[model samples]
Target: MAAASAGRLDPVDGRRTSGARGERVAAPAAPARPAAVRVRPGADEDLRPEAEAALRRLVGRDDAVLRDDQWTAIHALVAEQRRALVVQRTGWGKSAVYFVATSLLRARGSGPTIIISPLLALMRDQIAAAGRAGVRAATINSANVTEWDQIHEQISNGDIDVLLCSPERLNNPGFRDEVLPRLAADAGLVVIDEAHCVSDWGHDFRPDYRRIRTLLAELPEGIPVLATTATANARVTQDVAEQLEITGEGAGRSEVLVLRGGLDRESLHLNVLRLGDQPTRVAWLLEALRSTEGSGIVYCLTVSVAEQVAAQLKAAGLPVAAYTGRTDPTERESLEADLKANRVKALVATSALGMGFDKPDLGFVVHLGAPSSPIAYYQQVGRAGRGVDSALVVLLPGEEDQRIWEYFGSLAFPREDQVRATLDALSRGGTQSAQALETQVDLTRSRLEMMLKVLDVDGAVKRVKGGWEATGQGWTYEADRYARVEQARLAEQRTMLDYESTDGCRMAFLRRTLDDPDLRPDERCGRCDNCGGSTLPAAPTTEHVAQARKAMDVPGVVVEPRSMWPTGMATLGIDLKGKISPAEKTEPGRAVARLDGLGWSQPLRELFASTTPDGEVPVHLRRAAAQVLDAWDGLQVDGVVCVRSTTRPVLVEHLARGLAKYLDKPFVGFVGPLGGHEAPPRHDVNSAMRLAGVAQRLGLDLTPAASAGLAGRSILLVDDRVASGWTLAVAGRLLRQAGAGAVLPFVLAQQ
Candidate 1:
C-alpha cells in the first residue's frame, strides 16, 4: 500500500503556515476521484492481458510480473483517463508503467504518447526499451536535429507510437510555435520523466521544467499526464503532485494519484572510507576498484577532478576515461555504449552520468568525494547494484567538499539588478539573441540564457525566431521563495554531513531522507560497513602513495587561444566581430595549473587571496614557473612582454622580468591600463563585453627604444592569471602590430 503524507520537513519561518519553498499554501487536500475513474477493491487483476503481455515485452522477459501499484497506475491512466504521479525508487518499474500505458492507449487508436524526458541518454534508453515492446518511438533533441523532419512526418502520419523530447525543447521558438500546438492536440498521454525537477524544492530543479505547467494547462481536458521520479522528499512530492493536478471538466479539483513506494535498495553495500589527503583518497580508490568486481563508475564532483582521477587511474593501468558536461554529445553516446558493454573498467564522470543510465549487472560505484546532499548521493549510488546481487558503494569525503558547494551556490539565483536589466533590454527589442542581450546585460551568456528561460516561464519574455523579446507581462521574483530554497539547500547539506558521520543503518538513513515513512533508523541492514565489517584496505601502500603523489603533482595545463571573436560585438559598439584572423591568433598557451586543480591550486589560492599582500613572485612559485618555461617546446622568444595586472601588478612584472633575465632576452615593457577602463565585474559577464572592456583598458604605448628592440622579434607574453583570455589576445594583437614576430602566451594559472 502507498504511504500517507507524514507532514513536511519544517517551515523556513518556524511556523506550519508556509509549505515547502515557503509556498503560502496548505497541503493540497487529495482531490476527489471522478465517479467514472473508480476501481473496485479487487481491481488490481483488471489490467488487460495485452497490457501484461506488453509489460513482458518491455522488460524483454517472459516472467516479468507487474507490481500491484504499477498495474493500478496503468489502469487509471489507460482506462479512466486520470493523471498520476509515480514516486518510486530508481530500479522500480516506473518506465514500465508509462510504456505499458502508451502501448494500451495506442492499441486503442489514441495519438502518440509525448514524453518530456530529461536527458539524451535517458531518451535513447527509453526508445530502445520501447522498441523491445514493439513500440515505434522517435526523439527530437539537439543531437537528432537532422532527423526532426522525418520524425515530425512520422508523427503526422501516425507511424510513431511515442515521441520523446527534452524539457528545453519546449521553449525552442520553432518547436513551441509550429509543432507543439498540433502535438498537444493529438498527444494521447503526456509522461514527464524525472518529474522531481519540476519543483524548485527538488535537488536539480531546471527552470525549463516550469514550462510544463503551460503545456498542462493547454492540454485538452482528461488527457492523462504522468510524472515520475526516484528522488523526492515529502515537500518535493507535494509540490510536484500539486503541479500535476490538471484543471477542467472531469478534473473536479482532483489531485494526482501519488503512488510513492519504498526506496530501500537491498543490493547496495554502503561504506565510507575516510582518508587524509587527495593522494590518499585517490590511492584508496585505485585499490578498491581493483578489488571490486565487474565494470562500474567512479563519480567525481568536478570536471577537473574527474579528469585528474581518470588520468591517475589510467596511469595505474586501469582502463578508464573521464566524462562530464563538457564531453561532446557523440562521445558521450559512445562512452555510454562502451560502459554498457564493459569495454572499460569505469567512466570517471560527474552528475552527467546519473539519471536513466541502465547497465544491469554493473558492479560498483565509488565517489572520489561526497555530494553535498544525501538525496543527490542516493540518486548517484543507486546507479549501482541494479541487476546484481550486491554492488559496492563507497564515499571518500574530502575537505574541499564544502568549498565546492559554496561555489555552486553562487550560481543559484541571479541578482535582482541582472533580472531587471534583462527585462529592460528586451522591452525595446525586436528580438535579441542571448549573445546580443549579453552586451546590454552584465551576465555571462550561459547565465543570461538561464535567466531568460525563467523569464519565459514567468511570461515576462517570449522566445521568437531570431531570439527573445519582452512580453511586457508583469513578473515578480519571489525573494522569500528563493531564500527558502537556499535554506532548504543548506539543510540538505547539513543532512549529508550527518549521513557521512552517522553510525546507523545506511540504507535506512537514505530511505528516511527520502521521507519513506516505514523506514526504521535503528533497523540494521547488516550490509553497510557500519553494520558489517568494511571490505576495503586501510590505505594504499607507501610506494603506491608516493607514485600517486608524483603523478598528481605533475603541473602545466594548456590554455587554448580564443579563435573566434564573440558574436554581436558590433551591437556592443565594438568594430570587432566574427572569426579572429588567423594572423592575429596565438597558439595554445601554457599555465602552471588550473585554479581548480588538485596539484598547485592550494598554494595558488593562498597566493591569489585578496587578503594576501601582493608583491614579487614567491620563491616556490618561481621554481614552478621556471619548470613551465623549461617544458615549453623551445620557442625562440626574442623579447618578454608582460600583461599588466591591475590587481597583481608586482607579481606579473616580477615574473616577466625574471623570465626574460633567465632566457637572456630583452624585457619588452608591460602593457599598461588606459583611462576609462573598469575591471570586469565580479560576476561572469558575456565574452563580447569582457573583450570590449579589456580592449578599452589595456594599451601598449611602446617607447622608441622598445619598438626598435621588438621589430621582427618573437615575444613571450606573461600574465599572473588567464580568465577569458581576452587580455592576452588583445595584448598579442598590439604586440604583433608593433612589429613583434610571434606571441606565445604564458600565465601563472588558468581560472
Candidate 2:
C-alpha cells in the first residue's frame, strides 16, 4: 500500500500535506459517545513543509516522498521532542530522517546536531550528504586532529549545523572532561549511528559504544535524541532502546518509539556454493571475477588470505587490491575511490570493510569463508543491490572457517580472574600507565586495554590524565550474561553452517534469523541458486586449478627480529634495556606459514595441536621444511640446534635430527633447559612480562659436545612456534655469548 493511503502525510512536489483534508463533513455524533474534537499538533504541521523541502534538497529529487515511518520518526523527534530508535534496513534512508530532523530543528534557532558515528567512512559520507542540504557538517576524528580547534570554534560561533564523531571520542579525556558537557548542554539532537554496538547482545559489541549511555544521561531534557541501526535482532533492539531512553527528569516516563521494518532485500540474489579445498575455492573465485558483471567485493576471513587472493588474481591479469586493518588511511581512501569508479575488478577485504561503505551500483558480494553469524552476512550482502535491480551474493564455505571463528571468539569478555587481577592492580587509586600495569598483570597489552575499556564503562575504573586508576566502585562480573552471549554466538555459527546447507530460500532464512516481521518461512526466493537453478560450477578448469595450487603452495613468511628490549625488565630482575646489541640480535627469519593461514596451516596445526606428549615430525612436513631451507635467500648456517621444549621435546628433537640429516650439516646436541627444568613460562602476558617469566624460569646450559662444535659457526635455532619472539631473542643471545658466529631462528609457524 502507498504510505499516504495508510493514514499518513504525503511528501509530494517537495511539500507534505495532511490526509485530514479529504474527510467528509458529518453531523455531530450521537450523545452515546462523548463528542471529541481533535486538532493536529500545530508544531509539527508548521515544520512539515520545511522538512519536506530539506528531504527533497538532500536527495536531489523533486518528487521525493518520506515513507510513513520516516515521516512519523521525524515528527516525533522534531514535534514531540521525544527519544526514538529507528531500526530499519540499510538503504532505507535512515540518514535522511536524521538530516531532515537536523534541518528542521536548526531552522528554529536550536543548537547544532551531534551524531556519534562508528566508522570514518560513514562520517565522511554523512558530511558530504549534509552539505548538499546546506547543513554545514564538520567531523572530528582521529584523522583530522589538526582541524579540531577550528571545528570547535565553529561550533561555539554557531557556524556548524552538524558535528560527527566516533563513540570512542565520548570517553577521550580531553573531550569528555572539557568539551562534552558544553555540547550536551546546548545540543539540538543526538544521533547514534550503528547503535546496536551499544548492546552486549549485538553481534559487534564495542565497549566504547557503551559510553553512549553516559552521554545520553548528560543531555539536557527536551534535546530529542535519535539512535539508528539496521542489523539489530530482537534482543539487541530491546537492549539498545533501554540504553537510549532519556534518564533524568523524563526518565522512563516517555516511551522511546522504536520503528522496526522488515529485513528482506528483494534486489539481492543470495546463494551458497560448497567448495572442496582452498585451491578449488581460489580458482572458482578467479573465474567468477572474470565472468561477474560489475565492481564488487570479495570478502576473506583473514588479512593473509585476502592478500594471497589478491596476489593470485593480479597474477592472472586482473586489477585487484588487498584491503585490511593494516592498510594505510590514505591508501584506504584511494582504494575506496577506485572501487567506486570501477577501476578494479574487486577488492579482497576483511570485516574492516563491512559496515557503512556505500557503493550504489555494486554488482555482487562473494565470501571466501562464511562469517560466524547470519546477521553479519546479511549486513555485508546488503552493501550490494542497494541502487540496482539485482545483484549476486555467494558464500563459499571453507573447512577453515570454524578455526578462524574460534580464534576471534577467544577475544570476547575476559575471564573472571583476569578481570579481578586488573582491578587489584589498580586498587591503589593512583594513575598507572599500561606499561607499568603490565608488570603486575598477566594479560597482553591489547587484551588488558580492552578489559580496561569495559571496566571503565562499568564504572569500576576511570581514565585520567596520566593513565587509569580504580574508582573503588563495586562491580560484578556478569557470568551468566557473558555465558548467554557466548552461547548465542556459538548458535549463530551453527546457524551459518545450516544456512550454507539449507534447501529453503536463502533470503527467507536470513530474514527469519533476524526475526523479520513479514517473514514467510515456506516461501522460496526464486532468485537463489537452489530455487533459480543458477548454482556455481562444481569445478574449475585444469589450468586455473594449477595456477591456484601454485599460489597456495608458495611458502616462507618473514619473521622480523625484535629490535628493542621489552620495557620494565629491571622489575623482572633482568638487566636488559633499550636496544639489543647487533652481535646478540638474530636476523630476520622464515616460517613455513602463519598458524592462521590457508596454505599449509592445517597440517602444521595438527602437528602442534598435541600438548601432552610429542611425536616425531611427519614425513611431508619434513619435506616442506627442507623446501623452506632450499627457498631461503640468506647465508647458509653451519649447524642446527633445537630450543628444548618440555612438552614437545620428542617433536623438536626429531625435527632437528631430520633437518640435519637432510642438509648434510653437523647435528649439534640440544641446548636443553638447565637443572632438568622444562617448558617456557606461562605466556599469558605482554612482551615485558613474558620475557621476565622466561628469563626467570628458563635457561640454556651449553652441553660439552654442543659448546665444542658451536665456535664461530652459525647455528639454526629451531622452536615449535614463534609467539612474541621473546624465546628466540633470549635463546639467540645465549648462543651468541657462547661464541656462535651468527644465529638464525626458524620455526614451524608464527602464531
Candidate 3:
C-alpha cells in the first residue's frame, strides 16, 4: 500500500520532500481491490509458520516501511499500551503500522491477524500488498464466489495468516458457525480499519460497526485490536475504546493517540467560491477542469448528479469518469483501473469511493458541492495530493446545492411514526433485507432507504449489505446528516443575503470551529480575505473591539476588544444587541431572549466588559465554568459544549453524572429545547435529555426525584439554548417543590 518517495512528488524547488517542513510522503505503488475476509478467533497456530518465516526472512532484507511514530503507535497498540487515540492522516504511513505489526507478529507466529476493514476494496488492497510482501494473505466476503470449503481450508490448514473481512462478514451467522470455530481454536489478532465507523455520531456511520463489540465478545481476552482511522476526535476514540473493551492493562487503551501534527501541505491552496447559478457553476467547474489540469475528483451530492456531471464533462471532451453506489461492480473496477493508470483525468463521485482511494496525481480536488460534515469534507478533499505535488482543494458551491439538499432532505426524510412502524415490523419479523421491504412496508426502496437511515439514528434498525434489520433499541437518531450540507448552504446564503458578505474573511467562517492553540493567523498566507487582495471587504472578527462603523444606518457595537475564554465552546464571542450572523444568534443573550419570549423572569440582563481586552479570560470565571462544567454532572466533558449531547455516553454518562453531581450538591440543572440551525439531524432525538441517579455504594444519596431537603440546596440552571424552559421549569419546579434551595440560571456565551 506504500511506495518509496522518489520523483513521485516533484518538489516545488527542484529538491526532495525534505525541505523546511521536512514533509515525508510516498505514493502507493501497489494497487488494491476491495475484497472482504472473515476469520473467527482461535485459529490453529500450525498454519502461521509459513507466514512467520516469510515475514522474518523479509524484515532484515527490506527496511521497515513505517515511520518511527507509526511503529511506536503500532507497538503501543500490539502491546496494548497506547494512552491516546492515534489519528494517522493520509501519507503518514498508517497502513505500514499495521503491516509491520503483522509482519513481525507473523514472524514469531503469534497468531492470525484478523483485520476488520470497512470495505472489500481496502482489504483486497492490503491482501495484495501483504502477499507481495511474502506474507500469506487472503479475504472472506459474500462476494467471494469460492466454495465455503475453499474458505475453511485456508483457515483450518493455517494457510492464511493475514485475513481481511468487513463488519458485515463478521456479523454473518454462516461466518460464526462455519468459520469462527476454526479461528477461536487458533491464534488470531483483531484489526479494525476505518474505526470511526463505530461512531454513528461520526459523519460516516456503518451500522455493522455498532455490533463489533458484541461480535468480539467471545473472541479472545488478550487479542490485540488495532483500530485505525484518518480522523477521530476525542469522542469517537473514546467510543471505540469502550466498544472494543480496551483497558489500561490489556490490548487497548482508554484514549486515542490523536496524531495532529502532520504536513499541512501549505503548498496546496484552499479556496471556496459561490456562484449563484447552476449553469454558471457548471461552466466554472468545467472551465477549472479544462484549464487547471490535474487528476481530480468532482464530488456531487448524489449518484445521479455525479453521473450527470461526468456526462457533461465527458461531452466537453475532458477525460472524465464517474463512480456511484449505483455503478456496476464491473464498471467500478474498470474505472478505478482507468483512474490509476491516468486514462481518466477526473472522476465525479458520491461518498462511495471510500478509504485509501489514492490517485496521487490528483492535481485538484474540486468539491463541486458541499458534503454533509467536516469529516466528510476532510475525507473527500484529503484524497488529493497524497503523494503528488501539492494541489488545490476547492469548494465551488451555489444556492442550488441548498435547493438540492433541502429538496432531498424534505423528501428523503421519513416521518417519525413511519420509522417507529418500520421498527415495529423489524421487531416482529426479525432481520429483513432491502428485498423484503415490500412485505413489511409499502415504501419504495429509495424511501425505505431514507426511513432505514432514520431508523439507524433512532437506533431502531441496523443497515447491512442486504437491508434494514431491527435492533432492540428504539429509533433515537435525529442528528440530521443532510443538515450540515444544507446548513452550509443556507449559512452561505445568509452571508450573501446580507451586505456583511462583502467584508469578512470567508476562511474564518470556514474554519471558525477549527483552532490550534499552537498556531496563529497570518495575513500574508492569510488564506483569509482580510489580509489578501480579496474582493470582499474584511469585517471585524466576530468579536473585534475596534471603533464602530456605521453601515446601512446601523451602528457597530463599538465595544472594546475583549478576549474570550480560551476554552469556551466556540472561538467567536459576541455581545447583546450586537448585529450578528444567523449562525451566532443562539448564544447566551439569544438564549436569554428566547427565555424572555417564553415568559420567564430575568434576574440579570447585562454583562460587564472584561478589563483585559483580548487577553486570557479572567481565571476566576474560566476556572469556575470549566472546573464545574468540565466534569458537569460528574462526566468528563471537553471541547465546545454542544447544545446537547451527541453520543449516547454523553447523555447516558455525562449528563446523568453531571446532573446527579449537581443535585447531590444541590446545583441547578437546566434543560430545554435546542435548535439545529447550524447542524442538521444526525439522529432523530427531538430534544436532549439528562437524568441523574446515584447509589449509596458510590457515597452519593441522589434518591428518587421526590427526596427530602432537595429544595434547600443552591442550584444553577444551564442549557445549550432556552427558547422554552420546559425541561428546566419542570425539573426545577419538581426539585424545588420536593424541597431544596434557590436556583440561579446561567447560560453560556450566547449572541
Candidate 4:
C-alpha cells in the first residue's frame, strides 16, 4: 500500500520470485482441503511476450514462476474479470499474490494494473522494488510529481505495469482522463491493498476507502477487483464483499479465502504488563528503549501523546523519531528510514505507524497506552511479526485509558447530521473536489471515503470519474438497512474487547478477532501479568504528574492540574475537568488559545505571569498565561473538538462565545443551524457539544434572515468536528448574496 515504494505496484516481473515488502512468508503451503483447484499448467512455457520484454528492460533474473496458491492468487489478483477476496495474514505472502498476479496479466496481455494501497511509502517501495525486478512500477502522490501529464503518461501508456494510487487521486485528471478510459475492458486488475479499509467494521475506519465501491462500479464487469490485507475479521469480510458487490452469482465470481497462519512469532516473547501508575509505565518504556536490541515502535493514542512520548524518549538520551500527521512528508520519510536503518532506536507514533512499516526484527511494539478495540490492538501489535519473525506487544495502560474508552468508544459513530452535513458538503457546486470535501468533513480521510461510499449507496451523492456529485437521491433501503444492521455487528466487536479486558483473556480474545473460532478457552499460560500475578510480567502504569510549581508561570492565580476525577462546581462543562497534559507536569498553569477561521481568528497567544520561570517565560509569554498557552496548544489539536454542529439557537450562542473572535466580521449576527441530535449517538455532534458547553448554558437567539448582514461582513460557523459543515452551508451562501463578502466557518477538525 505504499503511496511510493519500489516493490509496491512493482513492475510485472514475469518471475514470481521475490515476495512483497521483502517477505519470506511462504505462499500458504498448498491448500489442504480439495476443491479440484487447477493452476495454469505451464511448467516449461515461455514467458509472456510482454513479460520477457519487461525483463529485458530491467537488471535481474527472469523466468519467475508461481507456485500453486501463488498461481491461483496471481491470476485472481491480475484478472480484468473477477471479484475475489484474499484473507491472507502478514506471514502468508499475501503481497506476492497481488504483485505476481498483476505482473502475469501485464506479461500475458496489455493494460495497466491500478493498485489502491494504504501508504505512500508502500507505493514508493513497490515501484523501487519493481525497478529492481526489471519491472517499472510508478507511484503518483502529493510528493515529487505535481503535474497531471506525468501521471497521465505513466498510466495511460502501455509501458507502465502498475499505477499505485490512492482513492483520493481518482478525481485528478491523471486518473479520470488518462487511466480510467483504459481501465474499462483492460486485461488487468484493480488491487486494493489493506482492503479492510473498504469495510466500516474495520478496526481503522477510512472514509475514502468506501469510494472503492464506486470505483468498482465503473470498471467493466469483466475487470476483477482483488482486495488483499492481513487484518480482517468476519464482519469486515462480509462488509467488504457487500461493498465490492462481490455477489455469489454467475459471472460475478468471487472468493473469500483466509490464510490462517496466526502471526505469532514465538521467538518474540509475547507478554502483557500492567502497572498502577502512569509515570512508572513511561519510565519502564524508556528503560525498554534503552535496553532493547534495535530500533522500535511506540504506539500512542493521539498525535499529542506520540509527541509527548517522543520527547520523553528523547529526554532519556535515546535517538528517538516521531511519526504522526503533524510530521511533514519529508520528516516522516526520513524518520522511517532512520528507524529502519537503526539510526534511531525508538519511533513514537500514533495509528500512522500501523501500515507499511516494513522494518522486521523490530525490538518491539510498545503500547504506551491501550487502544479502543481488540482489532486495533491486533493490527498495532502485529506490526512486529512481519513476514518472517515474531514480535512483541507491550500493552501499558493506566486507569485513564479504561475510563476514556468506557465513556467514549461505544458512542463513536457518525451522527445523522454529521452524515448529512458530510454528504451535503461533499456534494457542493453539485460536485466538489476531494480536497474541498476533506476541508469540511471531520473523520480521517480513509474514514471519510467509507462515509462517501455509504452516501453513494444512499443516493446522497454519486462518485463520478473526477470527483463527488450530488445524486438527488437517498441510499437504497437495502444498503441503509445493511449499514444500520452492521452498526450492531461492529459494536459487538467492541463489546467483546471490553469483555476480554474484564476477563483477562487477551490472547484468546485477539485470536478470536481474526476469525480463528477454534481457539479454545485456556489458562493464561503463565505468560501474562494476569497469570504471573504479583510477578513483573510487563505492563506499567505511570502517574499523572502536574508541572512543577516552580515551572508554573501564573502571576496571581494557581490552576492546579485537573484531576481524572471531578472537582467542585463542574464549570468546565464536561464529566470531569480537562485531563492533565504531559507538559502539565513540567510547565504547570500555562495556557494558550487557538481560534479557527484562519483569516478571522486572532493569532495564537501564550498567557503567563510577569515573572519569568527562567528567561522569556521559557517559550515566550509570562507565567500568568503559560498554562493558558499550553491549553491553547492542546485546542489546536485536530480531533479535540467533539460537537460538530448546533441544533438549538442557544447552543449556537454558546459556540459563538467560544469562537467570538473567530467570527470573521467586525460584528455580524451569528447564523445558527440546528444540528440533528437524533442521529446516531456515538458521533452525535450535539453530544460532543454538550460535553464542551452548549448544553450547560442558556439558549441563543437567532436574528431574522433579513436582519443578518450579507455583503459587507463575515460570520462564524461553529461545530464540534465539522462533519460536512453543510447543515447551514446554503445559509452561508445566502449570507454571501445578502452582504457578507466572506462567510467564514470554523469546525473543530475537518475530515
| Model number with the top TM-score | 1
Cα misplacement distance, residue 264 of candidate 1 (Å): 0.9
lDDT of each: 0.81, 0.81, 0.48, 0.51
Worst 10 residues of 4 by lDDT: 597-606
Deviation in angstroms for 14 in model 1?
Answer: 47
Model 3, C-alpha of 694: deviation from truth (Å): 55
Looking at candidate 1, what is the lDDT of residue 39? 74
Q: Model 1 over residues 1-751: C-alpha lDDT tens digits?
A: 3211134211000111111111011122332221224775655555557787887788765545565567778888987788888777777678888899999888888889999987788789888989988999999998888999999999999999999999989999889889998999999999999898999998989999999989998988768888888898888888888887776665573666777677777779999878888887887788877877799998888898898889889989998999998899899999999998999999999998766788767789888878888998999888887677688889989887887888778678888888998899888766888888878888877788888999899999998988899988889988899899999999999999999999888888888888874455577778898898446655789887788788877778899998888887777677787787777777678898887667676678779877998899898888888888888887688888888777777899999999999889988788878866536324276787888787777789667899887777888999988888898899988888777778899888888
Give each model a TM-score. Answer: 0.93, 0.92, 0.56, 0.63
RMSD of each: 6.5, 5.7, 22.0, 13.0
Which scores higher on TM-score, 1 or 2?
1
Better-scoring candidate (TM-score), 2 or 3: 2
* Candidate 2 lDDT, 1-751, residue by residue in tens: 1233333323322223333212111111111111112225585568677888898888777667676677777887887777887777777678988999999999888899999987787787778889988899999988788999999999999999999998888778899889888998999999999988998887888889988898888777788888888788777877887787665576544567777776666678888888788898899988888888898999999998898789889999999999898888778888988998999889999987758887778889999999999988988898897777678888999888998899889888889998898898889537887877887778888888888988998999998888899999999999999999999999999999999999888888887787665555586678887778355544688888887888888777888988998776787678899999998988788888888777877688777774534788888788788889999987588888888887787888888878888878877866656774565567667888888766665556656877877778998888878989988888888888888999888888988
Candidates ranked, most accurate by TM-score first: 1, 2, 4, 3
lDDT value, residue 648 of candidate 1:
75
Q: What lDDT score is found at residue 473 in candidate 1?
A: 82
What lDDT score is found at residue 184 in candidate 2?
Answer: 87
Model 1 residue runs over 4 Å out of place are 1-37, 40-48, 676-683
